[model samples]
Target: MNADEVLAIYNDLAAENVPVWIDGGWCVDALLGKQTREHADLDIAVAREHAERLRELFARWGYQPQPRQDATDWNYVVATGSGSTVDVHVFEFDDEGNNTYGIEYPKDSLTGTGVIAGRKVRCIAAEWMFRFKTAYTPQDKDLEDVRALGERYGFKVPATHRRPAPRL
Candidate 1:
C-alpha cells in the first residue's frame, strides 16, 4: 500500500473510532516517520472487543476474509476487490494490562505513536518491532528494516540480521 492509501485507511478507522495499532512493516515505516519500502498489505492490531465491529466496517468497504490455512479467530487477512488488504491481529487485555485473549501482544507494545504523511497515528513501537524481527531468522527486508531502525534509533543491529553479499 502507498502512503495515501495507508493514511486513508487510518482516517476511516479513526472516523469510526476503531482503535488500531499499526503493525508489521508499515509499523516500522510509521515509526521512522517515512515510507521506507512498498508494502504488500497493512497490518493492524485491535482490541478483541472491536474485532467484529472492524469486520462489519470493512464489509461496508467490500473487504472479505482471504482464506488462509493458518487462519484463526485472533488473526486473519481481509481484502478488497481492488487488491487492498488489511491483516488484522486481535487481542484483549485485563485491567492490569496483561493480554488475556487472542494474540498475546504485550500492552506496552501498543503505546507508540508515529507520523504518517504528517498525521500522527498509533503504531507498534520501534523497540518492539526490532525485537519481533530478530526473534526469527531475518528475511532480507527484515534485515534492511532492522538496519535502518537501528541506525535511526541507536540500537545495535544483531549480526544475524546482516545481509550476505549477492553471488556474482
Candidate 2:
C-alpha cells in the first residue's frame, strides 16, 4: 500500500479510538520519515481487546479474513478480496509488562511514534524493529528494510541479511 492508504487506515482506527501500532516494513519507513520501498500489505499491532472492533471497522472497506495455514485468533490477514491487505498481529500484556496472550510485544516496543504521509503514527520502536528483522531468516524484502533501518539507526545488520542485487 502507498503512504496515503497507510495513513487512511491509521486515521480511521484513530477516529474510532482503536489503538494500533504500525509494524513490519511500514514501521521502518515511518521511523525513517520517508518511504524506502513499496509495500504489498500493512502490518499492525493491536490489543486483543480491539481485534474484533478492527474486524468490524475494516469490514466496511470489504475486508474479511483471507485465511492462511498460519491464521490464528490473534493473527491473520484481512483483504478486500483483491489488491493490498492488512495483516493484523494482536497481543496483550499483564500489569508487569509481560506478554500474556497473542504476539510477544514488550511494552517498551510499542512506544515509538513516526510520520506517515506527514501525519504522525504510532509504531514499533526502531531498536525492536531491528531486532525483529534480524530475528528471522529474511526474504529479500526483509533485507532491504533491515539495511535501511540499520543505516539510519547505526545498527550493524548481520551478514545473513544481504542487500539484494538490482533487478534489471
> Which candidate should be chosen as best, given lDDT against the real structure?
2
- In terms of TM-score, which candidate is strongest? 1
lDDT of 1 by residue, 7-70 (tens): 8888998899898999999999888998889899999999988888899999998999999999
Over 4 Å off, model 1: 165-168
The clash numbers for all candidates, in the given order, read 0, 0
Decoy 2 TM-score against native:
0.93
* Tens-digit per-residue lDDT, 105-146, candidate 2: 999999998888898899999999999999989998888888
C-alpha local distance difference test of each model: 0.89, 0.91
Position 137, candidate 2: lDDT = 96
| TM-score against truth, every candidate | 0.95, 0.93
